[model samples]
Each structure stands twice: as structure tokens, then as C-alpha cells.
Target: MSYSHLLLALSVVFVWGTNFVVIRWGLDGLPPFLFATLRFAFSALPWLLFIRRPAVPWQKLAAFGMLLGVGQFALLFLAMRADISPGLASLVIQVQVFFTIGLSLLTLGERVRGYQLAGLALAVAGLAVIATHLDATLTVKGLALVLAAAFFWACANMVVKTVGRVDMLGFMVWTSLFAVPPLFALSWWLEGPQAMASGVMHASVGVWACVLWQAIGNTLFGYGVWNWLLARHPAATITPMALLVPVFGMGASALSLGEPLPLWKLAAGALVLCGLVVIVVWPRLRTALLRTNA
Candidate 1:
């Protein structure tokens, strides 16, 4: 990657990393389901007017949207609203990596490598560490919800893999169309109509700004630039930068929200990141070694 492209990747990850903080701000007024409804609504509309839908089955699109918007984000927002801090939410959601691997093994009959198994074990250990340290800030319900969200995120990834390559930006927008109505219905049912009305009426400018940031900055700009980079470079070259997300998430939470980072948290992060390093980097190293030997 060129210096400029490197900066672009960094910017995308930064936006994504800080997005947890943005979600926390937005939840100050709106209920989780309502907040999620508005997020996908704004993400789809206006741009959806201009962007052509990708050439994929409506069922596939709808499935991906539901998995991503409702399964992943709704649960995530709810967890963050009451149970978990943004920093830990960011970290916990990364378990989707392991979930995706497990799903592929079961659903697609893909063989797991030694490194992947090692990575999974390490990540599970990290989760076990987190499970032992629950408190007012990090409740069991919150951890469970986030894990569910991560599972859904992994399911969404499977949908993408099945769909093959298409215009992902367009896919995101159109599928977002499928996500909105269900989310609105869910908000009405669970959060209550009165709460939704009150939230809309009393929403401050800052909260609205956070919502827009989630839609425009995090979704549009972040995914847009990320896909652009992937188009230009190898997946291996660009994807590893995602490891910075939790790092930035934890740092931003500490700086902005004053969320403390105890030794346990640091240890958990190290174990999980080292696992990810083995999964992502070890393959590249092995391939290079094989080429040199050959």
C-alpha cells in the first residue's frame, strides 16, 4: 500500500473503532432498537436513491441485512446501553472471527488449520478471563448479548461469502432497505410506542449527530474506503490492520469515557490479539518460508 492508501485504511479503522463511543452517545436518548432503526434507515435512504442495487437474489440481500442490522447491531446496541462499556464491547465482538470459523466448519465443511485452532483456543481463553470479571459495568447478560451479536455478524459474513463478489456498498444500502421495517416494528413492540415518540421529540442535537456519524461516517465512509482498498490490494495485505480496531476502541474509551483498563483487561487483549496474529500473520510467514525453500 502507498502512504496515502495506508492513511486511508487507518482512517477507516479509526472511524470504526470510535464508532462504539458514537453508539454510546446515541443511546443516551434513543432506545437500542429505535437507534438501530434510524441508523439503517439513514444509511439506506438518500444514497439508496442514487446507488443501483447489486445483482443478487432478494432473499440473500434480506438475509444478510437481517443478520447484520437486527442480529448483530440490535443486540450490540442493547448490550452497550446497559451492560457493557464501549471498550469491552469492541473487544468482545471480535469473537466473531472464531464464530465465523466454526460456522464455516459446520456449514461449508471447511477444514480448520492448526493456526486457526490455536487462535480459537487463545481467544476462548480471553473470553473466559472476561467471563470471570463481570461487574456492574460488564454484566453476564451484556456479555451474552454481545456474543450473540458476534455470532450474527459471523452469519452475515457467511452470506457474503455465498453471494460471491458484488458491489458491497450497493448491497449494504439495498439490504438496509430490508432491515428498517423489522427494526421499527421491533422498537414499537419492545421499546413501546411512547418511548419511541418521546425519544424522537426529546432527542438532542448531539444524539442526532451520533446517529448520522453511525450512518454516514462509520457505514458509508468506513466500508466504502475499506472495500476500495480490498479491491486494490490483497486481502491479507489490508485485513490485518483490523487488529488496531480494539486497540483504538480501548484507548478511545479510556480517554473519552474514562473507562479503566485493569491488568486483567490488558491480559485478555494480549491473548486475543496474539491469537489473531497467529491466525492472520502465520499463514503469510509460512507461505514465504515455503517459497524460499522451494
Candidate 2:
């Protein structure tokens, strides 16, 4: 990878890592759906003003938004609100990686490599440990919701790979546009107009700050740079950089929220990180150092 690409990847990891803390902080004052709604609303402002609508068909755009924006965040926020540890939540959502790969095979005809299969096996085992170790009397419903969010994320990934021929930033912008109304509608319907009204009126400035960071810092800058890098580099170079996000998420959550690092969670993190190193970094390093340098 070029130095510039490496730097961009690092920026994404940093922003994404810090986002977990922002979510936790934002949740303190804002209801989950309300927070998600306002987040996209804030994120959409710049896109509406500057970026043109994406060239993709309307159905594709709407589907992408439904999966990535409404489906993913709705469940994620609820899971967080249900007291799934932020760090653990970061770790768990990674199940999407495997799901994405699996779905890509079925839908996009992308082949899943042997090593990827191994990584999936390890991830599943790790999830078992995490789920088994959850606090007694904790229902799997919240965990199931988060996993469902991951499935939506996987579907969105496939959408981007298949349908996102337009500029990456533009795709995000339009999808967010398509997504915002449905999200707000869902919030209004389920959480009630009065609760949302009360939430807006009573939300703290700190909560707003959290929303801003999530929208601008994480969503815009983070995804913007990420899409840029994806356009510039090979998937081999770009995709693995995302693995670092969960590390940052877990660590930041633990530190910011005073969440514990159970022995199993730490072990699972090590396994996942090690697998990422093997899948992403090791191959690029070998190719660059041996083939190119030689």
C-alpha cells in the first residue's frame, strides 16, 4: 500500500473506534431511534447541498439505505440500549464479515477463500464464548437483534459491491437521503411523537455533541475517506484495514464506558486480530517485500 493509503486507513480506524464512545454518550440523553434519525439528518445536510444524486436506480438506492441505515442502526442502537457492552458489541458485529462473504458467494458469485472459511469458524466459536458468558438472565434477544443488524450490513455490502458504480461518497449520500425518512417514521411510530418531542426538548448539549461527532467525524469523514481509498486501492489493501475498527471500538468502549474485559472477550479479540493479520496484512507484506523488492 502507498503511504497515503495507509494513512487514510489509519484515519478510518481512529474515527470508527471513537464512534462507539460517541454512541454510548449519545444514548445517555437521546432515545436510540431519535438519535439515529437526527444523526442521518445532520449527515445529510452537506450531501444535499453539494453532492449530486447518485446514478444508481431508485430501487437500489432505497434498498441500500433500508439495509445499511435503517436496518443496521435500528437494531444496533437497541442492542446498545439493552446493555450489550459497547466493546463487545464492536466485537460481535464483526460477524457481518463472514455473513458478507457468504452472501457474496450466493449473490455476487465471489469465492470465499479457505482462509476466510477458517476465520469464519474462529469467529463463530468466539461468538459462542461471548454469548455463553453473558450475564445470567440476559436474553439472547438483544444479541439476536445485533446479529440481525450484521446481516443487514452484509446485505448492504453486497449492494455496494453490486450496484454502487457511482462515486462512493455519492452512494452514501443518496442512500442516507433515502433512509432518513423511513428511520424518522419508524421512530415516530414506535417511540411515539410525544417521546420524540420530549427527547428533542430534553436532550443535553453533550448528546448533541455526540450526534455531531457521529455524523460529521465518523459518518462523513470516516466513510468519505474510506470510499476514496476503496476507489484508489485494491480490496486486498482496503478491506482488511477495517478489522482494526473493532479493536478500537472494543478498547475505546471499555475505557470510556468502564466496561470489563472478560477473559474470554480478550481471548476472542486476540484470535480475531490475529486472523485479520493473517488474512489482510501478511499477504500484502509478502508480495510487496518479496516480489516487488526482489
- Which of the numbered candidates is closest to the native, going by highest TM-score? 2
Candidate 2 per-residue C-alpha lDDT over 238-273 given as tens digits, one digit per residue, 9 for 90 to 100: 555565666778678778777776687777667656
Over all chains combined, what TM-score does candidate 1 have? 0.85
Model 2: lowest-lDDT 10 consecutive positions: 231-240
Clash statistics: count for each candidate: 0, 0
User: Residue 44 lDDT in model 1?
Assistant: 95
State every prediction's TM-score relative to the real structure.
0.85, 0.86
lDDT for model 2 comes to 0.73
User: Candidate 2: deviation at residue 30, Å?
Assistant: 1.2
lDDT of 2 at 165: 43
Local distance difference test scores for all models: 0.80, 0.73
lDDT of 1 at 287: 88
Global Cα RMSD, each model: 3.5, 3.0
